[model samples]
Target: MTTPRPVDCWLTDMDGVLVHEETAIPGAAEFIAALRESGRRFLVMTNNSIYTPRDLSARLAASGIDVPEDAIWTSAMATAQFLDDQRPGGSAYVVGEAGLTTALYEVGYTMSERDPDYVVLGETRTYSFEAITKAIRLIEGGARFIATNPDVSGPSQQGTLPATGSVAALITAATGRKPYYVGKPNPLMMRSALNRIDAHSETTVMVGDRMDTDVVSGLEAGLRTILVLTGSTSRARVENFPYRPTRVVESVADIVPLVTEFAPVTGPEY
Candidate 1:
């Protein structure tokens, strides 16, 4: 067998892997620092389309974790990239906040409500029936449907709130058109992340707390994966899946040392 390359680039999930709401997970800050100090290319990624990278960076800072704007990636950014690739300088009828809108604008996309190239959906706390109606109408009018992510719900101080996927379902039920999702579990998102960083799958590692989205997508994208128990998944839950991550750890604290020096995890099964 050809020898595997060392872990050089890292793509990590942000919400469960780093911080939980306003609190930073133990050693997550150190893990970020270690990657930075090691000069490794890394991105703190999230599926939430509500906040821009700058906004997310500030939020992380509030939790005592320091990550720069450029080192962050979001579903909104990925959606914009996908749209830009598929139809450069296109038009869209968006139902999202500044993050999604700014990304589209930065990519030279014109926002239109009439005969748009696409009807883009994203996460927002203020979604209303009127907004859903508009999106459904646009889709029925020949606008291709697109969504930032497939997360059905998002966490808040109060509890879980309906997310982009839930709204997408509502629109689908009305129009019978399924949207192209541009975030995690799409493997396209992982490949896009790799392209954004100029990372080779052989030399990159994906660290996440979700078996369904993170580990699965990373695996399908031909990258090594590490499942941490700091978020949505636990040890008992790992066996529920048919596949396995290259490694499983309690948290990011276990990975701080691997940032600078890691033996490539390259088993035949992995």
Candidate 2:
């Protein structure tokens, strides 16, 4: 078995690991504050593409966790970056909220609902049949399909709502083409976040609640992964899973102490 390595930087998931449905988790704010005080560089990496970095930062601040705009990295940003790199100046027909639309626009990707070069899907609160129909039409008309993430649903204030993956699935069934996913569990998203901090895999650790997406993505990226049990994943799932995280804690609050003790000591002890 591979042993865990010390992390110079940390990448954290926002929803489950930090908070649940706009309510901050116990000790979460303090954990982030401690990290900030220690001068540790950490980025909030989220698969949710519904909010731009500024929007997300504001939301976090509202919840008592003061996060800067640039400290937050969303799949929307990753998707925009990917599109810019792959098909620069290509037109995109987007079926998502203001956040997704804003990111693409900021990146200079042309937006159109007809005869577009690409059809990008993200989580939209107002997902209507008309929206799906328009996306399907564009995709069938030969536009490349791109999805922000594979999350089928997400927890909201009311309950779980359909996520972008579900819409992408509908489009896939209609067009017979799989959309390219640009979120967690995808190495590109991880690489994008790491690039922001100029951090390497060996020196970075990814902390999240989901093993399938968060832990798996970090492991695939050669980064140490820490699974916090405050969200979707349960203790039972962790024990039975074939791929285990480098460390498993009850919540993000436990990370600093865990890492402090678990990280390798450099000098030889007397």
> Highest lDDT among the candidates is held by which one?
1
Taking the tens digit of each residue's C-alpha lDDT, what string does model 2 give over 15-44?
998888778888778778866776777899
Best by TM-score: 1
What value of lDDT does candidate 1 attain over all alpha carbons? 0.91
Q: How many collisions per candidate?
A: 0, 0
The reply for model 1, stretches above 4 Å from the true place, is 266-270
lDDT of 2 at 99: 78
Worst 10 residues of 1 by lDDT: 261-270
What are the candidates' C-alpha RMSDs?
A: 1.6, 3.5
Per-model TM against the reference: 0.96, 0.93
lDDT tens digits by residue: candidate 1, 30-90: 9999998988999888899999999999999999999999998899999999999999999
- Please, what is the whole-model Cα lDDT of each candidate in the order they appear? 0.91, 0.84
Clashing pairs in 2: none
Kindly give the stretch of ten consecutive residues in candidate 2 with the minimal lDDT sum. Answer: 261-270
